[model samples]
Target: MTKIKICGITRLSDALESCRAGADALGFNFSSLSPRAITPERAKEIIEKLPPFVASTGIFVDQSPEEINAICRFCKLQIAQLHSEQYSPEDARAITEAKVIKVFRPEENFAVEEVFAFAEKSGINAFLFDAYRPDMAGGTGETIRASLATRIFNALGDSCYPILAGGLNESNIGEAIRSLQPYGVDTASGVECEPGIKDPVKIKAFIQAVRKTVF
Candidate 1:
């Protein structure tokens, strides 16, 4: 099954709704730069209430390995999604508290070999591909061009688990899944009524759309 991750969760109500709507994972934005950013204490409270089998992911941008690991342990996070370019392969390897997912903001003609090499060097298996924005680290609401995403998926094959992000919603999510066939799909602004707020109806529709395509 293709995984569905509802990212930028700010409220326990929104987190519970996403899980009830069939999200396999929920992302808590820990980056202060993001509008959806939540405090570690708040995140921990929400995570504690989540049902079992649903993964909790902490999104980090520009934090050190030590800081990321500390937050993961505190919140009991199952995954640490690193969204910064500053992290070296060594930094990724150093995150011991939870599984690491390195985010890549790739352009149309990015080198696939570079990504594959990084995965091998970092020993990271899961990667997230989000649209590249000049001033933001994801949550751009811009779609990665189908041709570019499909090309990367084909080049990498099963070497890494690629999760597609950026500009995904109920209307176009099915088409996006059919094109890229990613291991997972992540959405932040896509299913939101506004930044940091989720719309339950949109969340349900979005997941339903993805399921229809995957099965």
Candidate 2:
């Protein structure tokens, strides 16, 4: 089954709704640069109310390993999704509080070897692939090319867990899953009424679509 992650959660209501709708994880954006950014206090409040078996993930951009670990500890986050190119594999290894999920925005000519190196060197097995935007660090809602994504999956094989993101919604998720066969799928804007706010109907529909899809 493709694990489903509902991202950009800013409210406890949205978090709970996502959980009820069958999301395996909830992503909280902590990067102040993002429009969906949430404070650590606010994210923690929502996370604390969540039921067991649901993972709480934090989206970070360019923060030091120490800062990431601090926030992870404070918020009790289960996973840390790093969105900066500045972070070397060493930096990912330094984060001790949570599992690291390095985000990669692969372009048309992206090198799969670079991803292999990052995962092998950092000893991190989880990764999220998003659309490449020169001025943005994900949540762009632009889809990554299917050919390139397939190349990545073929190269990585069983070495890493790949989560597909970028522009995923109820209508196209089935096709994306069938083509890429990712270990998981993540969405923010795809199921949202706007940044930081989720539409319950879209959330339910997206999750249901993912659940019905077969790789």
Candidate 3:
């Protein structure tokens, strides 16, 4: 079944609502530039309020491994989503104790082999492919071609799991799942009234849409 991850969670109520809506995971943005960004202390408060068994993910961009480690530990994050271009195998290794999902910016000329090679070398838990835009690491609200994403996933062989992200919503989530059949799907702005603010109705509909695809 395709798992649902609601990203950019800022409030305790929103996080709990996401879990109630069937989200397997909740993503907390720690990237300073993003409007969804939350302090480690605030993330901890929200995470602590969540029911057990729901995973909390910390999203970072170009942050030092030490900083990532510190925040993850303090916020009790189960997964660290690295959306930085400067990530290296050493960085991944440094976070060995924490599950890592490395994000790849989909360039027009991106080669599948290169991404597969990196995933193999880093030994990451998964790969999240986000639409490439010069100024943004993610949360661009732009969807990449599913055919291209599927092709890359098929090429990865048994080395990595692929998670689709970027501009997914209740309307097209089923189509996205049918085409890509990703290990999981990540969303933020798609179900939000605004960045960091989730709309309960949209959250429920989004989860319902993804659940339909799974069966």
Candidate 4:
């Protein structure tokens, strides 16, 4: 089965809703650049209320390992999603403790070889592929090519799952899953009424769509 992750959660209500909608993971954006950004304190509050079996992931960009670890520890996050080109492959590969998911936008000068090599060296848990939008840093609602994402998946060698993101909604998520057969699908703007807020109807429909996919 393909897992569903609802990203860019900002409020307790939205977080709770995503969890109730059967999201396996809830992503809290800690990147200061994002409109959906939330403080560790806020994320913790929401996470604390979650039922067991649901994972909380912290979304970070361009932070040193120290900063990333600090927030993850504070929020008790189960996973860390890194999406920065600033870190040398060495630095990124060295991170330990919580499961790490490195984000790659193939169209944004992100070399597939570089990502494959990093995963080989770092032993990350997964790779998130999102479309590259020049003005926006993430979740721009633009889709990555199925072919390129599949190539990255094949290169991972089963050690890590490739998570498809960007431009996913209830309508298209099933198609994306069928084509890429990713381990999971991530969405931020796709199920939102606006940044930081989720639309309940959309959230339910999105998860339903995911469950309908064969992976």
Best by TM-score: 2
TM-score against truth, every candidate: 0.98, 0.98, 0.96, 0.92
Please identify model 2 stretches exceeding 4 Å from their true place.
Answer: none
Per-residue lDDT over 1-215 for candidate 1, one digit per residue giving the tens place of the 0 to 100 score = 89999999999999999999999999999999999999999999999999998999999997889999999999999999989888888999999999999988988779988788889899999999999998999899998888888888888888889999989998988888887778999999989999999999999999999999953
Error of 4 at 104 (Å): 0.6
lDDT of each: 0.92, 0.94, 0.87, 0.83
Candidate 4 versus the native: TM-score? 0.92
Off by over 4 Å in 4: 108-111, 154-159
**Ranking according to TM-score, highest score first:** 2, 1, 3, 4
Q: Tens-digit lDDT track for model 2 on 81-175?
A: 99988889999999999999999999888898998899889999999999999999989988998888889888888878999999999998999
Report the poorest 10 consecutive residues by lDDT, candidate 4: 88-97
Better of 3 and 4 by TM-score: 3
Q: Model 2's lDDT to the true fold? A: 0.94
Candidate 3 Cα errors over 4 Å, as ranges: none
lDDT for 160 in candidate 3 is 71
Worst 10 residues of 2 by lDDT: 151-160
Model 2 RMSD to the real structure? 0.7
Tens digit per residue, CA lDDT, model 3, 111-201: 9877767766887659899888888878888988776777777777566778999999999899888876788999998999998899999
lDDT of 1: 0.92
